[model samples]
Every structure is written in C-alpha cells, then in structure tokens.
Target: MVNSLSKRCISLLPIYKKVPWKSIVLHPIIHPRFKFTCWLAAWQRLATADRLLKIGVQVPLECSFCNNAMETVEHLFFDCSISKAIW
Candidate 1:
C-alpha cells in the first residue's frame, strides 16, 4: 500500500492546518460579523473587483473606496486611501 502511486502522492501533499476555533469564535473582543469578515478575507473569498472579473461580471475594475485603484482584496484592505484611513 505504501508503495502505491496514490499513497506516494498523498504523502507528498502538504498538511492543512486549521485556525484555533476558540480564538475566532469564543473571543469577546471580536464581533461575530468581524470574525466572519476576517475569515473571508483570509481565504480571499470576498467578491472584489478582480474576482468579479474572473467570474465574468463585466464591470469596470475600480476601487469603490478610492476610485483610483483596481478593486482587489489587497487594494481594498491595505492600499486604498479610504481603507488606509479606516485602518
């Protein structure tokens, strides 16, 4: 079984680590919505402009906050002027 190609590929695959559930869910300082948003952002699962383009949304790729930059996860979170102020 160990010598099989399937088992060999499985061994080469990287491990999937999970975040501590207590830290995200059980914490008092973090709001429930905030935790959900954080999880979505971490996974790059938010529907930003770039993702929209990939999914063929056919909309102009402009940052909703800054209107000068492409609306990507990084731009929306860190690079946009308005987001910078929010941070």
Candidate 2:
C-alpha cells in the first residue's frame, strides 16, 4: 500500500524536461553556492531587477554594472559589456 501511494504521489507531481545544462551546473566538484547560483540562472529564476520589478519591488531597471540595458539573467551574464569584460 505504501509503495502504491508513493507512486501515486509522484505521478501527481509536475513533470519537467531534462535540462541540457544540468550536468555542468550540478557537477560534484562545483562549490555549493556557485552551483545554486548557476541553477537559479539556468532556470532564469535569478532575482534580477526586471524580475524584482515584476513582483512590484521598486528598483532601477538598468544594469548595475553597465547601465546599458535592463538587468536580467541574460544581460548580466552575456550581453552586458562589463560582465563580458570580467568573463
């Protein structure tokens, strides 16, 4: 009965696709903090200004480092000039 209940519970849970970056982001050798950060970024769940604004928090939309565009996971990691320089 327990086994059947567990299977039913699991079946009720949401399904997600296999993310391509999971292996790289969750490598055993990676630091836990960095791994969590990468996980949030990979899911586009990082609390960037744009995301904060969506939840009604008042914050400037500009990128803090480059001020060229809205702060977002993509801009912070790739599109921002300052981040590109640092990387």
Each model's TM-score, in the order given? Answer: 0.67, 0.78
Question: lDDT of candidate 2?
Answer: 0.93
Q: Which 10 successive residues of model 2 have the least lDDT summed?
A: 17-26
Q: Write the per-residue lDDT of candidate 1 for residues 1-87, one digit (tens) a residue.
A: 656988889889999886665477547889889888877887788989899899888888999887998999999888899988998
Collision count for each candidate, in order: 0, 0
How many Å off is the CA of 62 in candidate 2?
0.5
Cα TM-score of candidate 2: 0.78
lDDT of each: 0.85, 0.93
**Highest lDDT model number:** 2
The residue pairs found clashing in candidate 1 are none
lDDT of 2 by residue, 1-87 (tens): 999999999999999988899898979999999999998998889999999999999999999998889999989998999989998
